[model samples]
Target: MLDALIQQSVCLTQHYTGSPVCNPSRAALLTGRYSHRTGSLDTLEWWGLERLALREEWLLPLGGLAVPGDLDHEAAKEDKEREARSDVHEPSRPSRFVSFAPLRDFVFQPAALDHYAATALFLACVRRLRPDFAPTADDARHIARICRLLEGMPLGIELAAPWAGKLPLGEIADELAAGLGLLATTLRDVPPRHRSMRAAFDRSWALLSVPERDILRQLSVFRGGFTREAAEAVAGATMADLSNLTDRSRLRVEPSGRYAVHELIRQYCGERLGAEHEAEAGETAEQVHDRHAAHYAGFLRVLEPQINWRASINSEVGPETGNLDAAWRWVIEQGRYELVQAMVMGLYHIAVAEGRYQTTLRLFDAAVQRLRAQRGRGEGGAGDAPTDLLLALLLFCQGHMCIDLGLLRRAEACTEESLAVLDGIAPGRLREEQTLYTKGLVALLRSWQGEFAEALRLRGELLSWLRTTEVSVWPHVPQVGTLFVQANECASLGFLTWHLGQYDVAQGWLRESLAIREQLGEERWRAYGLRTLAGVLRTIGELEDAERLTRKGLALSEAHQDRIGIGWSHSALAATLMSAGRPGEAQSHFVESLAVAQDSGHHALLILSLNGLGALALRRGNLDEAGQLYEESRASFERLGIAGTLRYAEAVIGLGEVALARGDWSRARARFREALAARACRAWEKMDAVAGMAQVFAGEGDTSQAAELLALVAHHPFTAHATRERVEALLAELEAELPAEVFAVATARGRARELDEAVECLAA
Candidate 1:
């Protein structure tokens, strides 16, 4: 699994700086500095270890292993003999013995016990707000990470944590107590670490009064982060009880106008209820999760809009620009994302209806776990159409999540298994169509990510398949996902074309897709659609309009707190700023964009931000800084096995500019030529390379060739841009190579801008 996580991961050289010892090394490691700097000193203690007989039960034995150094000691002989027996049983069988590494049933983070303590405190507040129960420290962290994704929930983790101060968290999580069957536990299962909150939650729950437990029961009705009104309605008690809860910090109200209960408490309440009234509790939990899921699905719907805010801005007396910040706030800071995280444990209908395809997958994983638990009691939640549908839906959703997470091979396997299951069933119109729709959507996503080039062909084939299906299949088919897929394709292809400098062509596709999104009437989505349009507008130099459109998109992204989407808008704004010669401001925006990529670990945007940073540095006359930024971007590109073409070539051009600044003509020419050979693909940014190449030729006394390259720049529709100072400088160098008479003629012929304009030109 660690290797799987590392698949799409790109490694970069990082310098190490910390202590090299054991115990004192922890201090240096924690501070990311040496013990000398951190004031930490060495301390050593012997840890006793001796293997004992009769301690091999799953949990006990895992914690009991105490082996001497490895050179195939006595204990290893039993395993070799077993392999020898297996080989004898099947003469052709290859030996499957691994001499060193032990196969384990569970993986634990030995270095992170302190981290677990910190995480528990953070999750306690969340546990207090939730209705069902408080989870273990481990579950609390998972919940917190998900909750933080919602815009209104940045402080969410602190709201839902559990007590870890009284007992071992593993005891509470009996289901996970197997520890690792083959790996030795570094610490005793019972220890001084047991005094933390993970143990305290169990004690606290046991201490709750019947009245408090009853109040908790009523609280379970509400799912996710709730409103103050919700607590008042569900708590089934007087105003004094509500006040008491608030006074005790058991309930918290956020500035975004939502109320929350701690998740650890919710987990505690939920676990007890299962033993007390199993069937009823399960149904209630399902209901709460379903509603929670439904609310956030609303957030997803708004992802495709292109808002018209000019009316509101114009209606105001002040200039429209001042309202931009306010508008940004109104659009982005909404409470939509909280429900999305709750959806991870939500009911099936909400997931399907909301088109939260990605989250649905995550929720399905939780459901599978729950189902297994239910199975332990000789019961099954699997049943009729809706229940079965949800199950199948979850399988497909999980498959898609794997795909988006960049496990393409695993994604394919999961989706295929899903398709096989669906095929075994009797056809229902909506279900049949949905299966196909999701399949098609994944195919297109693969295409959009530069993984598959035959996307158009595959999409066309899916469309053809849809047409072949009967209208009767409409009831089962998924329409929303399919519609979005069309919109997505148009948007993705539109950007590609814009990059290729075909603005008009790009606009055709973007406008059509944008119009569809506007008609969809989902505010967030319309905003997303307008983003695509803004990109097209910017390419054609409609800076003011592009700014407006992009802000609208950013608002939608913020309203939903969609990290992936928000980062994209940041990049969009930064690019426009770059073109407008606001590199200093652009640099800040690019940095913000890079932060978004860092948050999601999305490779595409991370590299894009680096490139943007490099360009901004060049604009600011910081050549060394530009080179570093370019080098950083190159490292990302190289790790991903992609920069050898576009990004690498662009970085080479940036290097050439740096060399030119130092009067290194030979190096500059070599860099420029090297850049051109690699710049085989179309990209508007390639203009920088062409312009630099012209400068190189002129520097080498190749007047005719330099003049031709300069002419290409001079005639470029975008070349007259106020930010083309670098190209103008290249043209000036060409002029120096020509005779005075021909230069005059060329100047008259508009081969050069008016000298004043040329002198005033700025780099784009």
Candidate 2:
């Protein structure tokens, strides 16, 4: 027994693997090699670079398996089909093998087996170290259970769990509780104490009072950390005695006014909520949940900004984590329009700054739902002026997101609706200059949509008004500060001019905006200015300049732990890197950008990052990877109803090329045609698609179609850099078709490698 072993032991001697992974940790654990030394920090993702599995264990002081797997690709179609078939007729519980396929494949288990022996040695040393305090039977039983667990494989322990009920009290309790609060599902035929963690947790649950039980049940509503105010709002109690209740540990007082319980206990509480509710008790159960959700939603709307103020006063000494994370989860998963909008607005605005133009769509959609619901019940409309302000602001926010995705028509509709509501409201609320700011935003978006004349005219109007008005002197203030209004107006003007081919003017405005942002310090709104400034500079072919600016923004975001901001900045930086001719770095940054965007639920930015990465991959001749990237980007765009993401078609063409390489001409043709169709959408998202289709057509021997397709791409009369890409692509395509005798033939990568062989040999 563990207790008995601890009572009598010699000096304890145990070794820990120095490797950081099965690939990295395995080497260290077994051979004392760190990740850097072994070059296996990310070996789990690479093919053949994985840590070697413990082909030979205990070769004495060594243990642990080397991992072997590449995880990026999906399971094979045949495997999935087989699983689907098995799932239908034969319903069997998934074993750890299949349930944790990718993770299990990557983990080294042999090294774990050695940990039990080490623990045993450590326990024996502890007792020997202090003979006066002999180990108890219970202690020995617990240590014994751990040793058994380490010997068994993942499923071996899982399957043996039920037998704990059958095992004797003192027999093999070592298999049960190995780590404090880090319980594993021990399934071996061990004794009751070693049998299962479920029993242990159940024992803990039976000890709480009704009030404490109620607190636990209510807290389950929150999935993340919750604040004290939020707890007060959701827990169905805010009595004066609550603090006393918390102090006694019956309730929990989270840091920064936020609280948390173990995830396992939360799940238990959820089960209790289900069991206690009656079948027809919709009001009894769901209503309470709805009220709870609403309260949390309102709390989120208020608390987020309040927390910022508290942190701003002293972020280093900011209030405890009381319940903020809980509020975040509440907004993230269950929020209605108000809460989600507040949450999005409250974020670091990295999404907007870094060019996560696509991710804000979910919040926009929620706002739409809110608007529709309000309208359906006629809560606020034309005559209801007070309510109309909020309604109009919500619509405006949605329109901004729509504009980000190139959904011009939908965006226009939203803008128009908000303006109509604006017209209906009294003259005293938001500023007149602010209205012009919106007008300018819509105008430039219209230009991007190809309504050049209308857009130009609107831009003129907005700029003229802004120049004429010294400052906002409105009797009533707009919700946003004057500084924000100025920054937004300037950024919008820069964007419009940049697209309209006025590089000098656009750059000037962007510079001013960026300068203003630099002075204002770090905040979500300022991040918007920083990102837009970088984007505008990039458009003017100042890629290096853009890179620095974007990275500056990214650094600020990192300092603030702004997930949305970091994602946005990294994405833009990737594009900047690509434009600066750093494909390898760009590719890596873009992938990380997309991952961050996906994790943050910023769909818009994820779409852009994916498409950008796909383009780089295609350029690098990784056509399979390119296609996957494009497909993923396209899905993100489509799912969020973010239209005008046809630029992803560039990768679709790459897919066609890959198909062509594999001798699948039919598939190649299909991909080419699809790319062409999407590219025809005419937004910037289609630029890559258009160029790609031309390349495909040239490759397929249709020079005339390729030339005609190429005609759509024109030289930017204003700037040499803008037209350089088109010229280069045409030359490369022509060369690809030439006979070796007439001219060298090669693909894009080949052309890059051998410049002489890559271009068409036009007559001198």
RMSD of each: 18.7, 15.0
CA lDDT of every candidate: 0.45, 0.47
User: Which tens-of-lDDT digit does each residue in 245-309 have in candidate 1?
Assistant: 54444454544455445443444455545445335333454343333334334322332121221
TM-score of 2: 0.53
Any idea what lDDT model 2 has?
A: 0.47
- Superposition TM-score, candidate 1 onto the true structure: 0.53
Angstrom error of the Cα, residue 643, model 1: value is 4.0
Which candidate has the highest lDDT of all?
Answer: 2
Q: How far out, in Å, is residue 85 in model 2? A: 34
Compute the lDDT of residue 364 as modeled in candidate 1: 52
Regions of candidate 1 where Cα sits further than 4 Å from its true position: 1-209, 217-489, 559-562, 641-680, 699-703, 712-729, 739-764
lDDT of 2 by residue, 491-602 (tens): 7667666554566887788777666645544254455567767876776577777888788777666655554566677788888888888988887777666665554444
